[model samples]
Target: MSIARARLAVIIVSYCNADDVDRCLRSLARSDLDQFEVLICENGGEAAYTNLLARLVGPDRILKRISNDSDVLDLPQKRLASVASCRFQARANVVRIGLAIDNLGYGGGVNAWLEPLLSVPDWDAVLVLNPDTEVDPRALSELVAKSAAGYGMVGGNLVFDASPDKIINYGLHWSRMTGRVIAIGRNAPVGSTPSAENLAKIDAISGACVLATRACVEDVGLMAEDYFLYMEDLDWGLRRGKHRIGIADKAVVRHIGGTTIGSAVTIEKRSDLSIYLSARNSILYARRFAGWRWICHFGIGLLYAARYLIRGSSSAGKVALAGLLDGVNGKTGRPKVVPGAR
Candidate 1:
């Protein structure tokens, strides 16, 4: 089926960041695409986001009951006359807001919405977008176009929300040999373009804004739920078999990197939770994919911990060490909250 004619479903998982979700929904309201649906899986937040969203998208547009399913709440559809007409408009799009009963981690939250969608065969593509992101109006369209062009999974270029002109990642490259996951264009200026050869293919796409075909998801399976937070994207890509992954540079998303867990400004300022999960997940990823080469993975982790300690990040080093040990012992799920963290 042609992507343009095919139905699209966008799933955004949110955790206690109502304001960020508001901004993200407003941006999506401006999408140039004619037809699509947004399924927002709200993972435990104290604020009454349903009411907040009603105000943003209008109460009349908010649906009371979507289905018998306890997990999903489908929002009402309000026709949008034009983009210049209002701040929030449901338009021709169907918006389903699913309030998760608990605080499911990233992958788990996504699966909350994804599982139900998978049962229905109408969708051609599914876009997993981060809540703390404001996508370019053309972003989804570009991603869909790429999916229709035969790419199994396609990701958009992500730029820092604070410094919109600085590139965060074009795509990701994971080296199984060294157990390293590198962001292709970490700190390059936004306008700088890569050579065609460099843009030809990528090892993995950022989970920040990934678009995948139904076929890809069916083949690769859902995002690894075991990875509660990080490295799930690389795992999904690696498991794609012979499917090609590509980046749509024309599709750009402004992302607030750590709105829920990490530092909003830079990766260098990652929080304890971010550090712990990343450290643990890296080990888990290697163990699952690398087999006997897991020893090399452990060595690389030791080097990482040493670098953190040498750089005077004692907390980072300590958490990383604890995480590595926990992963080796097969511990998983949300880590205990670091003291004094709100």
Candidate 2:
């Protein structure tokens, strides 16, 4: 008989956000959780990320194609899709980095690490984190604790990376009565002191920093690849509606929102692209789980988009439009990347 040690796979997904990735990796090296490996899915440049990731995880753990062997079509699924750590090395808590063949956007990028991690029968959980996030030293510990306590999916409190004292997302809530999936901890002041309730209730946790158990994923399933760039976390959250989602009050991570999706757009405006996704995904979300409430939810989304376009800044207006349109066509994946005209 053998005693199995708990194992965690940390997947960092990024594209052209090298600066943020550097800080994120550095911050992660300080985490209290020791039984883990860090796998970075580089949708950006392999050369640049190689050295940086090597410091935290180790050179052998970092996986990617050399500059001379770059290929585009085989990205996402191809990026670091294997786990080669022996029990002894993993018990020591080492992290590995991986680079994709092509950019797999959001959901796909994270899933790529699955191929490698899942193959390792002993690995217990996969924590998908955006590379632009900076987390507290105790963040990993808190998430791990939450899972062991039995809440399959646990999330950390995210704050604005630039302003660590500002709340980004604490947990999410879905009010069946109002047909709203709310961010329960949004706008809460970030500080040393806080109430118990603030950490107690979670509606839907975001993918920016989430801890997913192997059991939860196998039963509820992985994120849908169709939601390439957004809402996949919330979508996954809905799948586990019967169980209470957990949030750690002490686990704090700073996120530079939209580092990969470009700048933050205002809630208003008709960018066409963004509106499409917001609209389409919202409809898909409502219909998939909310049943009869889909229509009402869709109408609410329209009003939400309308008000933004009518009153918010021009940029905000564009965001409203882009999200709506993106939702409608079932359009997902990163916005097209264009080369500069230098």
Report the lDDT of model 2 for residue 132. 79
lDDT of 2 by residue, 127-223 (tens): 8888878889999888888888888888877898777877777766655544465676666777443356754555567888988888887777767
Lowest-sum lDDT 10-residue window in model 2 = 65-74
**Superposition error at 3 for model 2 (Å):** 18
The 0-to-1 C-alpha lDDT of every candidate, in the order given, reads 0.73, 0.64
217-236 per-residue lDDT for model 1 (tens digits): 98888888877899888888
**Sequence-dependent TM-score of model 1:** 0.84
Listed in order, each prediction's TM-score against the native is 0.84, 0.75
lDDT at residue 54 of model 1 (Cα atoms): 52
Give the candidate number with the greatest TM-score: 1
Clash counts for the predictions, in order: 1, 38
Q: What is the Å distance of residue 245 in model 2 from its true position?
A: 1.8
- Candidate RMSDs in Å, in order, are 6.1, 6.5
**Whole-model lDDT, candidate 1?**
0.73
